[model samples]
Target: MPRQPASFLPIADALRTRIRAGDWPVGERLPSRAHLAAEYDVSPMTMQRAVERLIIEGLLEGRAGSGTYVRTPRERLRMVRSRHRERRGGSPFRSDMAEQGKRGTWESHSQARVPAPDGIAHRLAIQPGDHCVRTAYEFLADGMPVQLSTSWEPMAITDGTPIVLPELGPLAGMGVVERMRTIGVVIDTAVEVPRPGRATQEEANMLGISVGDLLMRIERTYYDADGRPVETADITVPDVRWEIAYEIGIEQPE
Candidate 1:
């Protein structure tokens, strides 16, 4: 015999059907969990579990000191990754947001002369324990947190340079490609590998999503013209709110 579904799952399915049937309109408050439990003839705990599932599905939203409400649908934005964007000579992130009529901004914190951990050293082609510059970034679209990144760069390349700190100095906020160029380093390529993951508690807090929500983690590395790794970063994006799109160039025959 086949195993039975969890008790709350059927309840959740019924609630989803009702919501879709317009029993509660968008932005309308849902009835109390106790009332819902009595109506379903289930314990309050089971009702809570059913409601929480819908919340995670983005069909409902909870308000502090208020009841859960039907969520207004939101449009998922696209983040395009392409070499053409790097050639545009400005902040690619800002350009992306502007295309969608939203403002793009980021807050970053940099720590210089930090020792590279084993994993970071491998990515940057440096020895473990070598000094490096580490920067943490929180990116926002229209003042709402949407992405996060942490970058590592070898200190030997930028220790005495003006672009040592990613978000400070005259060349601040110019992205890795431009900043390295200012210091006489020509960044020719960047490679990114994306993987699916579940959000941890800390990540959930930062992106304003529930723990265990789906996310995409990207490991990106930039290389100089000589093929030396110059910078490496781990970028995080919430999968539900954003779609990662890649633009590839087709080579032309000479």
Candidate 2:
């Protein structure tokens, strides 16, 4: 058997070492692929893959026919902290928009008995195949789509509420928390879990973006006084429109 080419790691590592050692200063062009291949004693195809890996890692950028250059180290990510709890109000989506002087509206699509999705079922403490009243809505801020949400409530509890009514005005003026309060269920705390996910084809079309563009998936769950779960909502917001915040509480030494 003969030794093959096109493995990228060792080549990438060598280049990474040079860049980290300040051999290639910020905004400097690295040697061309043909040049790197000659220097590293590798074939062009193998050298190309190694360069591609660096580009994907944000350590390098390729300019068409111009050449590859070392990218200035840019912050990969940032977190915003707001100390005043008052600034962080209820309705994480709408409240933030309102704070920034953005008026928004919600258009309810429908509310009906539908089986919960696997994740929603687990959060709501319901069986995977169990029935639940699902409410879908589109949220708009300043006439622009901001978020799309679908909420699930176990049928046993919502069957007595007006959740299934045909009329499609806001389910309750005071929002989900208030509506549940009407049923003697008071939610004291809620948590939102967000993750990076690719927008579905339909979502990309509706949101005017390329299919599989980056998006944020938020799953919010509200818990009642007895520590029982009351509501679970899945929200999708465009990456440009929403920001996330977290509060960490410390426990005193026992």
Candidate 3:
């Protein structure tokens, strides 16, 4: 048997219709939960649930010390993933933002000599306890955070090299491919797997979105010319603000 929809779903649908009909204009505050509950003859908790559903769908937003309001629709920016980007030499992220006329910046914290756990070890083809350098980055466009990444690189590959710390040395803020080249490691290829997920409390706080908002999580690994994994990272992007685009190159017959 098919399960029936939740009681609040109908109310949510009605609220959505009202919003679309301009019952309240964009940026206008919604009526209080208690008032709506009384109007709908339901409990305040039920109305709250319905309102939350709209918020998650990007139709509404909540402000601290204020009330929920209709959300002003935001333009979704595209983040392109392609081999051509890697070949651009400088920071790919900065270049990406520049294409959109937005200033790109990031803050990163690198921890040295961290032990790799089982999952990270498998990704890097190293022992579970192998020492690695872990770096966490918050990427911003126009001073607003839009992406997050945590990367791990085997210390054995860069232990005594000048590029040991990703955010330090002469190539500070350079990408993985350029940084690895400084140590004689030729990064030739990369693989990325993207999955859809919900934002956790921590991720929500970082991205300034509601908990349980949609997110795109990408698992990426870079390989050397010899097929050895040089770096692995997990990247997070909020789906509400960004879209992922892939560029593929096709060769013509000679």
Candidate lDDT values, in order: 0.91, 0.71, 0.92
The RMSD (Cα, Å) of candidate 3 is 3.3
Tens digits of per-residue lDDT, candidate 1, 1-254, equal 99776688889889999998999999899999999999999999999989987886678999999999999655688889899888877677777788889998999999999999999999999999999999999999999988999999999999888988988999888889989999899999999999999899999889987677799999999999999999999999999899999999999999
Q: TM-score for model 1?
A: 0.87
Which portions of model 3 show Cα errors greater than 4 Å?
1-14, 27-29, 42-71
Please list the residue runs of candidate 2 whose C-alpha ends up more than 4 Å from where it truly belongs after superposition.
1-93, 163-173, 247-254
TM-score of 3: 0.85
Q: Sorted by lDDT, highest first, which candidate order results?
A: 3, 1, 2
Number of the top lDDT candidate: 3
Candidate 3: 10-residue stretch with minimal lDDT? 204-213
Error of 2 at 96 (Å): 2.8
